[model samples]
Target: MDKNKEKRPSFVKRFLRQTPHAITMLFGIIVLVSVLTYILPAGSYDRVLLNGRNVVVPNSYKIITSTPIDFLGLFKAIPLGFKSAADIIFVVFAGAIMFAFMEKSKAVENSVGTLLKKMGFGRKHLLIVIFTFIYGFLGVAVGYENNIAMVPIAAVLSLALGGDLILAAGISVGAMTIGFGLSPINPYTVGTGHKIAELAMFSGYGLRSVLCFIALSSMAYYNVRYFKKITKNPEKSLGKGLDEEGISLSKPIQEYSVTANNWLVLSIFLMGLAVIIYGVFNLNWYLIELSAVFLIIALLCGIVSRMGATLMSETVLKAVSLAAPGAFMVGFATTIKVLMEMGNIGDTISYNLALLLQDMSLYTSAISMAVSQSVINFFIPSGSGQALATLPVMLPLGETLGLTRQTTILAFQIGDGISNLVNPTLGGLIAMLAMCRVPLDRWLRFIFPMVLVLLLMSCVALIVAVATGYN
Candidate 1:
């Protein structure tokens, strides 16, 4: 027993070290299973009279399989690459450049810092929670640009509140993800799902939004508990040697004088915000026209702030340079979409899952759909893509099972929202982490449990739907 006890800790340490790679290995197993299942056919059994007794037996012993891809099929699938992959890459590049400019200028940092100082966040926890929630809400309502702004604000507030920077980063991500998760109007995920599924334009999207609101509220409550504990015991909370990192903001805030250089920075940020607002809100202008406006703003600000024409050209060039890495990440994500198409992997996987769900009892089908979609979400990460990819298969299966399409769609939305809490690949996560200066490990410590809680809540919600049936 003593020997076993000593061995257990080492085993656990090894398991923990291997778990991240395990996720990748598990995904590979899933893909292999998907391909085999898609390519192999099981013989159908039929009832027959054998001698004097009725019996069931497989008559046709040959397995049959059909492949979706020939040269023609591959050619046809290529156009989807542009639609699914290229667009995401281009948009991400545009957004990143816009953000880098905002960050370097200190517009995001100063604006957020200035606001938090006025709120007296150190003395009050309620205001901080409310303000954080609002920041998240505005982020979703405004989409990506406004969401990016919320990150710095959330981080600065974390410093003001005397909370751990890492915890603050997690909280920042939680808020942004909440907004992204709940979005009723955004065409990317929920809205697109509703349209593709032929559900109402607004549908019960409002219901999912309400659920996200509840989830965010629960998260905030937990954060308050932790924040209060930290505030009461600063030494324990800050820990030893955590202040050494250059990223740590516990140092005294020095007064910064806004010079010509600073004003030049501020103008670039304000112009970016103006362009984003105009583009996203559909503010009665062409995208090209809006781009022109930003260009003019950049030029005029540069000239007024004593940035010579040559320097202005260099600044634009430099901003584009900084955006390139983000563009690459986005491109890599798009490449996954392309590969899935090439493999017909998405359709095959969805069809198999749908088939499995269809075999379950009716109530089970609804709950199973939620559980299944939630599991799939850990990989896809894009709620709209998951919805689009799976709904075609699941919706037909749901109809055949006599389940309400709306209910199944609701299940998908719930599953999608809950998974976002831990989806590290999300762009909003990087922004939030950068803003709050939190490492990934610290985030998982708090957030992983919270996500599990939300997952349990989702199960409970689905059970209620199963028990009551949809109105």
Candidate 2:
């Protein structure tokens, strides 16, 4: 039996089993939640979801029915939403390309291998764990750059070490997610959550950092255990390579010629750095548009280095092509938010959940709201949107139940952050997984435990908030 396997079913497990067997399960859930919130009347509640700053009163069925869903209308609206999420896609792609050039140049690989060889860090599992912790920490600091930058390193190192490629990618990508999940200043997640809740910009920073620390620790422990098993019986745990039969450990490392690679590599790295800096500082979209110039620079450099225009054009086009699904997911996700606002789904979900727990004690209300936020996360993947949609409704209930609004906001962040790890629709996770060839089942196996630990920890923290009257 696998040592890490759990014997009993948890609530989340049972719920996941019930999820539709579709590639894009979240989209189906979105449609269902849309109907539930818009079609069903709030029996005794006053408010529904919001549009801008307006309260959606129930019995506004006419407005819901009249929502414009024409093909052209959706087409037009999607670009705007894509524009909103454009910064994220741009940063993700540029960072990946930049990191690719570095790895292609053998700079990162040689550096990591030399460092590991010097330190005798051949215990693959322990090294992975330490790297994961650092990755997670830097994720919060350097933010999304870590994902684009480190994923290739992890993959290359795992290959060189004769270990799991997927495991290496997991440590690097997961750490970056941990930071993005617990961002201090990034407008993508935490900043958006604050805006939604109408709370101070930094209100949830401390709690997020604490949760991120614990979650990363849990992930490291899991990695260490896996490595220990692999160490005990390398063949059985780590499995054989693709060329298993009669294969010797004599594969020649692929070499990139410096003369032919330098200019292209240099152009990619410099341009990527510029874009990431601009994104971090929340500069104008003109900076993102400037990527075209960088692509041109890469092309010119490649041409000068005896590289064909076709190769350079193909590479840049491929990079752009890889980003299309991410852009689409963003637009689709934005539409869900628009629908919720149109149908007043946020208020309905919040108000009813609130009233159901209104009679409970303060700690109970806090716990309940935390759990509710996790559920709300499925429908509203954007942390900010979920916070905005649900906070108004949940905050008032927290007040009535003698719970702190601040605690509720923190709970919201925790729930939203954890879901992003496994939510198939989260473009960053999807792209990272694609790069690593890690299927959803494998990632879920590794991540589910960490998610439970983080969720329970968050609930307990919220309980403490209730006890101390934090706000």
Candidate 3:
């Protein structure tokens, strides 16, 4: 090779580098779903508010005249999605602001470095396992969106602990998604699905707990493996070039003291989280309330750090500028659902899929229901929303096929939970990816294998549930 001549990049490398941006991918999805409106029949189910949540009325579905999205209407759905998802977008922006303040204060860096030092470099990877379980528990306890504010902190910790952005997101969002998917107590999916099935609350706790363990363990393993690969060879990292320019593990770890100011900042962050958890479990707070909690915490941190108003304002503006793309991606991802609703096909797709499960064998029907739920999740990313929309029809179909309600709920849990790992419509996933500066295409490529394994494991669990006649 000529010393001064640059080597040509390989074709595979060129193609990988050329992968479409997350926003572009989401836009393409919007177009595809809009087209689906024309090909798939338009239909809907009557909906009523139950316990302050909108739920589809059981046995109320009917085919309606098609209202396919036209070209102009397709473009209109983007803004419509933005309007509907505004709360979440605001949450993302607020989180970025908080993270920026934390970074500026050295609060995140000092705290993470100190924690890793205590763990020792040899045992550092253990942090992944620990945080994975912690986030997983939170996922089961609270909903996924409620944890969006935590991603930036996780990213900081990941980089500090000799890992990359993907690993950071994996331990946080990835673990939460796993927990959300398999949680027996996740009120959003499990609670709502059981209600729609008229089954006792958290009725299948034993099987679900076992599945949760299996899924989390699998995720922890994946995280460790990827961390090791990137640690050994930085070029293997999806964040290779990006990591060098921003946060780098090669940077020396500073000894963070437990100063009074550090304590105040840390205490404020922890107290805010505790209150948020309390509100979620007790007060039933959602996106807007969660965003407020973090916003308050950010302000408190800035005050404790003693940054003047000018500096604080500048910091927030800069953080928001960096996070702007992520905020937009969240809104764009929501357009998939917007388009589906505009075409009146969200329920139609579910209705038709449920109709197909009428004659399947118990095992097959159980697995098929899970698969259908996964597909439905792409359109209705909200756990409670999917439960309300699909479980009504799935429960009746499960009954007709002699499948236990518990088995049906199991299908719903797996279907709704696992797909979040890859669903573009999931705002939290997009926001987390954006925070870490990882493109959605790269994330899909990295996570697709793990998703397949998780899905297979879920199928096996469903089979066992059917065999044991789980109730």
Best by TM-score: 3
Please estimate how well model 1 matches the true structure, expressed as its whole-model Cα lDDT.
0.55
lDDT for each residue of candidate 1 in 330-398, tens digit (9 for 90 to 100): 333333345444553444445556668857887777878877777677546666667655665566677
* Pairs that collide, model 2: 49-344
- Per-residue lDDT tens digits of candidate 3, residues 260-314? 7777887888899899889987897888898898789889899989999999999
lDDT for 176 (candidate 2) = 73
- Which portions of model 2 miss their true places by more than 4 Å? 1-104, 121-123, 144-150, 183-208, 230-271, 282-306, 314-347
The candidate, 1 or 3, that scores higher on lDDT is 3
Report clashes for each candidate as comma-separated counts: 0, 1, 0
TM accuracy, model 2: 0.71
TM per prediction: 0.67, 0.71, 0.93
Better of 2 and 3 by lDDT: 3
Residue 332 Cα positional deviation in candidate 1, in Å, after optimal superposition: 4.4
- Candidate 3 wrong stretches, greater than 4 Å: 1-19, 52-54, 243-251
Query: Model 3: which ten-residue window has the lowest total lDDT?
Result: 242-251
What is the Å distance of residue 116 in model 3 from its true position?
A: 1.8
